[model samples]
Target: MDELLDRTAEAAPQDLTDGAELRGSSFDFLTGPGIDLAAKAQAFHAWAQTRVAHGVFPYAKRLGGRPGATAELTLLDGRCHAGLNFSSQEYLSLARHPKVCAAAQAAMERYGVHSAGSTALAGNVEEATALEAELGELLRMPEVLLFPTGWAAGFGAIKGLVRETDHVVIDQLAHNCLHEGARASTPNIHLHRHLDADHVERLLKRVRQRDPHNGILVVTEGCFSMDADSPDLKRLQALAREHGALLMVDVAHDLGCLGPGGGGQLELQRMLGQVDLVMGSFSKTFASNGGFVASHDRAIKEYLRFYAAPNTFSNALSPVQVAIVRACLAIVRSSEGGERRERLMRAIQALRGALTEQGLTVLGHPSPIVPVMLGPDALARVASREMAQAGLLANLVEYPAVSLNSARLRMQVMADHTPALAQTAAHIVADALQRARALAGATH
Candidate 1:
């Protein structure tokens, strides 16, 4: 491995020459005299083309027209279709809710749309400040800092917290954002087996034995997005405390639907107070576009507010989004809100039970996110396409995103979906799987 790394490093500069022809070919098309912007553009285009050729190109198309499933999503050849939307992170289906929409409209009327500049450069909108304070109070944290996106939150937090000598311990199946953030910020990062508290403990012991002075940060997801499985947060938190390590929980998937008041897996396990840092995305449950990091320590929040690139460089959350999120939080905390939670849970249970009864290997517990383990990438893709044809939009997970051999159909159950709808979708998936298996056998 050392020799390979050395050789790769040696060849890094020379690798750029392989695309020299493509780079030079585009230079004449540019009218700019300075800045060598044409070279950068050519390199970017070359990389994009390579990704497309590899069948890994993402978001190459746009969704046009409406707000719901009938919207002309880019992948469906721009046709307006009403398939069940399983790919969206809008967990609560609050995006089109009348109350949420009305709140956003009201905010627009009162404060206009955009914040006009970065939050630090100009005083952030009052609505944004209120939302942050509300979130901090709801989460039982001292303070909270918001970012433009979840990626920014992850990146900025890791960059702000860790130093060169510090080490980060993360789950092997952690999100790309966390992995990238840790990699860019710290040199010593150890990825432990997914959801294995024992493995994390052992790694921490080894790191401490090697360098007792090394600052350690353990990272894991509250609920994994792909498998929909939650970690043993109580055990992990205990282990982190025992080892004098800080624990950071990424509650992106679980925050809206999991805990007593929708606080998340950590809160469900009574470990929220023990957790050192909690990060989440508002785009999912809040049905808004932004992310936040909460901590009991005010100093950490202040440090990230000033030092984190996401907080300083990016534009603050729109006033309209902030207002909508505040309204959503109010609804989520209301006494009547339990009905929506219960309804969604029942829908998830019905769908999961139906899929399991059909003899499909459903991953995780009966959570809102249900994944049917369809082996091989080709079969998963075929199943997804077939389900779309059958009036359901299930996502096909494959290489790089998940284990190459463990492709599956990732389906999310919404509160609006009735028991009948969930069962119908499950049957469609089962039928598609059987047909796919038969076709493969015949071809073989």
Candidate 2:
């Protein structure tokens, strides 16, 4: 609709080569030495506006209605089609559950659509209070704090609790919110190789050696979204204890989808109570848009409530969101939750096996998230486009999201997706990969 294929200018002669040809108009904006911020953004927008015609960018097709394992999607050319979806994070498929929907509708009738103000002022409804208590009980923590969004929770946790004198050590593959929070928390930041607890201990040791009394915080995810792998929480917790550093785990991807009672990866490893802090999102598993930070220490919880920017400034979760999350949480704690998780795992394994049987290199261990290693930016984009055209919708991750040469299709399997559906999607992806390889000049 907004000039999808119009390039801002003609390509330079030298820019018509291999890697150079793939460089969009942002090359000058990103790499040029003396360009002003405004000019760079304008140039990038001009380039991005034309990418729809190139069959890349604006990755997700517009959904005409409710999204599920299979849904109707509208392409850029206004062609509507039904597609098997592997791009959603609704692992339990609770978003569309009748009970959850009913709870939300009832809450909307009682409390309206908006929270009205920040929790610090007038936004702390009865539903919010009840949800917080439930989460606290679930985590076996003394205190729990909520935020409007998971991103805000992570950002606020580090910024609110860690001082300028603190040293932060985070997993290299931690989510962007954690990275941003660490950057804002302190200048003394260290990164450890993903899932490498030894590296984390070494960083912690180095920090302790340098600043004997400075507080140290270690952050990692329970399940990484891109790789679909989880660290050994027991080992990480031991490292933190030996180094006298606090460990914080973000269980956004694993909680409510793994372990007994859906306690998350940490609970599966028997390190739930040992970790100093736990934060997670309700959006992924609980089918609601909110986040919580829980800890055994009441002081930290109070401090966050008083100082966290989100708690202090952002509006709290609406009653409807809280109600749906509460309903989903109940389901996650029920026997049906286990059955759904089993289905989710079966779907993941089925798809993984299918992709591998097709001679595609699938990355990571058995998890709801699966990534097919496509390699190179161009190949990944082409494969994604072809796959979309073939009626399978998956997410393509390239440079910036991942390494330049490690571009991939990040596929997520939901409980509602049948094994047959997964296998069919895999076939489509395999066919798309072949086309993409031939297009990118790869043979075999």
Candidate 3:
């Protein structure tokens, strides 16, 4: 039976071409029996090289400066153009702020750029301590533990705290790092539908019925970046409390972009201190590299600080990054931050409205991310290519990132995007969608 299954699984080789890849590659490197991994990689490289020469594959274009709302992008054909950047996560536009730059320079001068060792061994610098303390205060948490990067934070928090005997129930659409953390921590993992409280409750009840004594962690995001929607925090909290489980929320996308005072989804939902744990990234809104896990439970904080691999093995965030984050946090808590938040919201609303008016399907509720759902992979690829040709930079979400049939053009809005730019972006995107539709139909 095993041999029969193996024999049946083999796929006949077919001619691979650019058109096939743009429509979605049929290659399955994982399921291929005794597959030549190196050869497959070479094949993919050839395909990518072909696409890059044509200016349709826009993975990473060489950037001249800080990747802001308007910056220079070097295309695949080696031609540089000033493009309207809708791919940046600088919601508050603090990346180029004078104060942020000044703080970084001062820190670089004082600390000389490197931390030299992890915080555990060398002790944290003054800026690191200040940043952690400020984050605790802003998030209204008793303690906060910082990681070198947001990816490390998500992966470390779960792996450090959750034991092998523990159970973790996560949203199906949670970030990839969170999924990694959950899987690495324990084998007893359950997935709940995105934002489906009922599904979570059912899973929780089932787990409780089987292992009432084991610790259960419920994981979710404050604002799902891909979908640009938030869960009902109040309901989720209540459910977790009723089930004797702890809830962890990642506010990486919304922490410094949404809510009053940029307090994030917890603040917007009025559940700041009610949730068990809150984690986020400073890179998005604070314009720095690092992430933190804030919680009232001091034991969990200490455990993560000591056991988390990133914290234990990885070097601490540089003094410059720490300083920049400290300065950005101060601005985010000020009146200027409030004004910037309002401006960001205006851009989001205007762009979403325009896309909808153009008869395009816009996904999610009100947020800085405006994703125009374009269904087919080929269609999304064509639209993105057309948009770039028109000097607009947007992100393409396709297979593995999202469902194959749910490909989208993800546009990120910044607070400093002018009204004229926004209007022009809308028209360009509308035209691109129209052209992509025709091209896709013709190909079919």
**Using TM-score as the measure, which candidate wins?**
3
Q: What does candidate 3's lDDT look like per residue over 251-296, in tens digits?
A: 9988877888788888999987788899888878889899999999
lDDT of 3 at 220: 97
- What lDDT would each prediction earn against the true structure? 0.73, 0.81, 0.82
- Please say which candidate is ahead in TM-score: 1 or 3: 3
Error of 1 at 223 (Å): 0.6
Sequence-dependent TM-score of model 3: 0.93
Tens digit per residue, CA lDDT, model 2, 61-144: 677556688765665544444578787788899988999999999999998898768887887888888888888877778688
Per-residue error (Å), model 2, residue 78:
4.5
Q: In candidate 3, which residue pairs get closer than 3 Å at backbone N, Cα or C atoms, i.e. clash?
A: none
Candidate number with greatest lDDT: 3
Residue clash pairs of candidate 2 = none
Order of models, best TM-score first: 3, 2, 1
Off by over 4 Å in 3: 1-18, 35-37
Task: Provide the TM-score for each candidate, comma-separated.
Answer: 0.85, 0.91, 0.93
> Which ranges in model 1 have alpha carbons more than 4 Å from their true place?
1-76, 441-444
